[model samples]
Target: MPALLRIGRTLRRTLLQAIPTVLGIVILNFFLLQLAPGDAADVMAGEAGSATAESMAALRSRFGLDNPVLVQLGHYLNNLAHFSLGFSPRYGMPVADLIAQRLPGTLTLMAFALTIAILLGVILGSLMASFAGRIPDRLLSIFSLLFYSIPSFWIGLMLIVFFSVKLGWLPSGGAGTIGSRLTGLPAILDKARYMVLPATSLALFYVAIYARLTRASMLEVKNQDFVRTAYAKGLTPFGVTARHILRNALIPITTMAGMHIGGMLGGAVVVETVYSWPGLGRLAFEAVMGRDFTVLLGILLLSSLLVIIANAAVDIIHAWLDPRIGAR
Candidate 1:
């Protein structure tokens, strides 16, 4: 009960700290949008083709563009308090609704990509650690470097060319079979099929980071006194390595995973665009291009919230894995 109470206190404190962080992000994003050149109203006007002064004024008033920046910020914050993200002038829908529509695709893609990264990274990192100073370790290091250095967009295009264009084994762009009505397992499989290339591209860079971090961490943990003690206590080599070395090394890997959430989201912008996948990243691209400030801010705030939550979760996991963390 005391431990649970401690965790509760930690969560409460973390949430209180997060409130100010979120407000600052909101304020900064609002001002940044204000500072950005080009008028959203003008963008709408141009798209409509030829606008008189009256029409322009009406457009500004309709979108609340006529309001002073401070008043607009106040209104935005007021709407946020009521669980509103404002309406998107570009999509002609509530920003929250537009985000809701795109959230599933982004979540799916990120889920697949992060899973691949974690699995492959842990495996490769273990291999490197087990084969330290051997050819296998060197080769894995080189492979990690290569993937880390390559741009995700380029990797995405290459995957599309090979898997979708040449082999025709998977989709080149977009989500699922275009215009085909699929349900149940068929729908899931179709979505996965379309997701392969983009997910792989997004995963590659993270894989590199995780592999390197894990390998270094494992090597360090392997030399620790606890690991030596485990081996001395009649534990099998595998047991000592797995229970002592790997488990201890995982603290750093867990930290990286938490940090990677943000990077993966940013990388999604490129991967989604390259593959024409209908995710938040692609929506963000369209929003920026159309000067859809509301949508853009909505995405930013949502992303920030996810990152904060992920970090808090990571801290809890860390405390669970090593009770010493709770003291810290």
Candidate 2:
């Protein structure tokens, strides 16, 4: 089959598979959230200091929290079918709108972090493999281990102190400068500056993992028959390493990176919280705190969908990198 045709088939199959997967996630998340202590109504009432029994009942009814568990689930699923993520009583807005407002920031942060992790990781890992037991390899190994051991939030804090407080080179928190009307390149640059710390903090741990994985993978691939053939063909060391060894080693690294995308989303919660970045992570945190089940459910559903899409894209990339995999 043609490559594009195979890719189309794979995407179709993956998306079809994702339907039941997303539905299951939605159902499970709804039920699991039900096990929590209070609903949105209860949280609202509590925050208001006091409410009469009759008023509390009305509040429950207003938000549809008065329904039976199964009934509530049906309503939620129905709303989802209509592409309505339900309404956030806590925020007095549609869940979809809230998510729309925040999704870009989260995506930008995730992209920045992932890019950093992959590029730095591959370069460092390549160097380490080249050096093996030399001083360069030893120093990088120590650096990777140290970053790997430190928590992301602590890293964010330290970065904030050193870069934002002491050096005054970056903003300490948030997605951008507050109340700034800057546009064009200035606006883009402002956001980039604010993003550097949180993105770096989130990327550091994964960088360590990727670096170690890449080093091991490259070393293993270097000993392969194909690598030996390439070397024997009189290819320069750099040419053999880059075109033969590194290319083959990338399969495992790509798979691992794809799997970690979802994990990075989870990690963003802590990083976002630490930096006060206004993204889906921060929104999810707020939803949890305020017992905004509707918003929380929306976030969870969307997050799962994003992960699914990411994995599907990875499959396509894998197929492209190794046509035999596509033939499968």
Candidate 3:
């Protein structure tokens, strides 16, 4: 009960700290976007091939782009306080609605990629540590380095060529087939099939990172006195490694994984672009090209919130894994 209380307190404290952090990100993203060369009005006018000075002025007025920066910021914050994300001139929809349509795709991709990275990485790292300096270790190290060095977009493109064009085993792009109207298990399976390439491409780089990190951490932990004692107590090598070495080494892995969530979000931009995945990353890309700052700002704010939430979840997991963390 006391442990639960400690975890609860930790969660509350983390959330409390996050409020200001999210606000700061919101303000910073707003100002940073203001520095960009054009606004939605400029893009709209360009798309129309030409516009008179009066038309441009009216467009700016409509978007509130004619307002001073400080006044615009104040208006944005006010709308945020009312739970509004403003409207996307490019998409012709509310920012919140646009994000709602895309958020699930991004979340699903991130979840699959993270799961693949962690599971494959931990297993490979454990094997490499066990074999330390053997042929297996060297081979795995070389492969990990290769994966780490490759750009995700290139990996994505290669997957498309091999799997989609040559083997014809899976989809080359998209989240799912259009107008299929699939339901239940079939729908889920269809989505998973489409998800495979992009998820794997996004995951490969992180898998390399976690694999190397886990191998190094486990090697260090294996030399600790407690690990030696566990071995002395006649525990099987697997048992000792799993219970003592890997468990202790997981602290660093967990920390890195938490930090990597934001990076993964950034990488999704490239992966989504390559695969034509209908996620926020692609939406953000479109917004940038269209100079739709409102939509872009909304995406940034939501992304910041997601990172904060992920970190909080990591903290809770840490507290559970090491009770001392909660006590602290």
Candidate 3 TM-score versus the reference: 0.98
lDDT of each: 0.90, 0.93, 0.93
TM-scores of the candidates are 0.96, 0.98, 0.98
When sorted by lDDT, best at the front, the candidate numbers are: 3, 2, 1
Residues 13-67, candidate 1: write the lDDT tens digits.
Answer: 7899999999999999999998888777888888889888899899889989999
Q: What residue pairs clash in candidate 2, if any at all? A: none
What ranges in model 2 sit over 4 Å off? none
| Candidates arranged by TM-score, highest first | 3, 2, 1
* Candidate 3 Cα outliers beyond 4 Å, as residue runs: none
User: Which candidate, 1 or 3, would have the higher TM-score against the true structure?
Assistant: 3
Clashes of each: 0, 0, 0
Model 2: how large is the Cα RMSD against the reference?
Answer: 1.1
Report the error of model 3 at residue 60, Å. Answer: 1.3
